[model samples]
Target: MHSSSRLFPVALVSAELRGDLTEDVYRLKPNNSPDPSVELALTRLGLPGREQRGAPVILVHGSFSNRRFWYSPRAIGLGPYLARAGFDVWIPEMRGHGLSPRNLDYSRNSVAAYARFDLPAIAAFVVEQGGQAPHWIGHSLGGTSLAAALGGGYLAPEQVASVALFGSQVSRDYWALKLPPVVWSGRFLLKRMGVIPGPRLRRGPEDEPIGLALEALRWYGLFGRFGERGNDWWAGLAEVRAPVLAVSAEGDRQDPPWACRKLFEQFGSEVREYLCLGRRQGFSENFGHVEMLVSKAAQREVWPQVLHWLERQALPLQANGAGGAAQGG
Candidate 1:
């Protein structure tokens, strides 16, 4: 196969196919409301309609993203595909982004908030709502949160079947969270200097929704650059004790092949897998930082591997929490 020329197939998403966004799908953490009213939005997609009917898989989006970002031309968005595969897909919009309420108290962003508020809230909700510990599939910042949650014990291993990360840097020179305060200060200065667009200015197609693009870029700026070689999720990988799959694009400047290799090595789980997708999968060589949920080529190349990995594990509802009826967020 001409990996460079191969065009991955993407399933078209129909308006009817779109899952309804409702508050009932989520379980918001108490007191944390108004500011971090962190909640996990659950929806039934794919072939099976029952929320608990399919293999439970949560699609944890990258920084500055919402649930809708997954629906792209090149990517079928795991929501629809996993749903079609008889896996109930739960898409969580991190706190301060998407429908999740913002921090009314703080003026600027805080990466730590996601680790403390969003990740836990979402994980607890999944368990409370009667779904099995899901297969956590994340991108960029989302991937980091998953690792932290696992490392910090915010989530238990039995609750998570496995993990799949796309274009995420666990620890490397370009790692985002480790950015020194000095670098952030410079970025703040750049923003003040009008070198960067204001909070709402956009760069993608005008017709396309600006929310995801803006959030993703904002995350990029806030987190700064964490090179491919700096990722270090070994602690979480070995401790979490779940199978993992890490995918990167050949030309992805943000998460080059080296970074993916590091994650694979540190996450020494025997079940772990890695793939270096090429640019022809769509997007440019710089496709390093975006969510595979938006990458059509990645959807075709990597998503199936995730699904297969999960199916091989197959955590039956009987083995998990007793099957329960689906509820609103």
Candidate 2:
């Protein structure tokens, strides 16, 4: 069995996640000694200097993942890459994930809850801690929640400098419209393999049972899968006036490249960028949704594009890409 303790120096004090991916990052928790203070947690690298001009970027991981996913070593992952690219980066641990408090009844939660409770809390916490809004980036469900929270007034327009979304959808109606059988198949396989458990990541006195988070939300095997949608996030997407970047993977089954493209086209931002990572980019033979962040080719080719886009968006009117020392761990 994997050790329950954190393997990294920067990790949250009490956070206990499997050390498979998040071995190098530190976890950020809310200030202690407050009533109802189950605020979201943040795992960060690259502390900001006083001389920094841009707002820090906060990262939100998708369902079934906490801050650790961003630190996976198979690929250079987003946290370190963005840090090296000259931005202060933070990855949030949403409610019931990693070290954050768990819900008494997991059934009482919804995707909207994460947007309303988790994202807003983290955004407020960032401002309170850093005294400024942040450039937010999210993956899959993470992006969906941030978009919804911002649109819903949980996050003010000024609190967010910009947003970057990867492989995410923005509508409740999207489930029936897209998604292949393989997604369902994967869920079934995982369940058959006994991976379905509650949302908490910390192991209990006994070994923690495997759990299904994203696909387990709905009884029909679809509605509750991605997240609370349409109004929750789409409402936020429509209300958001900030600049946005939407990224999609060419052969992704969960949220297809077309979905990301559609989201960018529908957004109100005048300065939006859309990217489609294809097999030609070396993402992989079948680069499924999660592999992009863990593929070396994606680190070499795709990550730089995201970093450059972030720099340009942060500075305004600047459009240039810079190369990084793409080394493997």
Candidate 3:
């Protein structure tokens, strides 16, 4: 580990060898974020004996979810799947989700804070420990934050080997929310609630702070931009050069394929690919938003596709073409 990593106030909260994989949970308290008291939990998974065999892969879970989304309680999911496949996998829990306790400003947390502060810290810690830039894979809001980080230059291209977004989209055009009155009214009501009850709303595994909803409403509103600063995150996407893989499910009503494709098309990466899941695409079922990453069908059909994408990132860039090859299924 680097001396800088040693200096980072990260505690090893737990460690246990589960079957062929060793699961370790870490609590990182980086001083760079606005909330110094915020401790982010990162779960590391690797084969018991081949810890350093492959490049590190960071799995960022979507909103209303946590590390468990990547690696469920039963030891199934992409985290273990990647680890078993020889890659060093790290699953990070956004503040107040899963094992990470709520911070003082829990209710105030937004994607801007996550993109500007939390992500850089997570990247720094991963790089410090892995001794190399890691591949970033995110689902839903997790993917949106990664895109924001890249666009805002919070996470530089050199700091990331590649990026893969699953069921992630930023070009939200919900008719109901797009209206000015509805947007304003929704923001007001949500902010007053302080937080969204994910379980009650049937959204996901955990509650999402109202700040996130406000941010979303702002983005979906007319004349809304992504960054907390005056930065145009979508416009800024034209500058990101990292290899990207954008995945969308055919049946994902929450984030439709068209919107997901819009997000993918904005990326300026020389190496990028788009994959859509559906029966027509040879998938067993038309995968939904959550099913694209969490269901057993995903484990059987989609995991190998992800592994293939990661393996390709390790190869030398070719001159015949930039990496933006589009494919289906």
Task: Please report the TM-score between candidate 3 and the true structure.
Answer: 0.92
Per-residue lDDT tens digits for candidate 3, residues 184-223, read 7887788689889999998877999988988887786776
lDDT of all predictions:
0.53, 0.58, 0.84
lDDT tens digits, residue span 111-197, model 2: 556666667656665665567788888888788777667666667776788888888774325454245574566555655645334
- Best candidate, lDDT: 3
- The most accurate candidate by TM-score is 3
Candidate 1 steric clashes: 28
Better structure of 1 and 3 per TM-score: 3
Q: What TM-score would you give candidate 2 relative to the actual structure?
A: 0.67
**Segments in model 1 whose C-alpha atoms lie over 4 Å from true places:** 1-24, 30-52, 72-76, 106-109, 174-238, 279-292, 313-329
What's the TM-score of every candidate structure? 0.65, 0.67, 0.92
In candidate 2, what residue range of length 10 has the lowest lDDT sum?
Answer: 320-329
Q: Which is the winner by TM-score between candidate 2 and candidate 3?
A: 3
RMSD of 1: 12.9
Displacement of residue 259 (Cα, Å) in model 1 is: 1.6
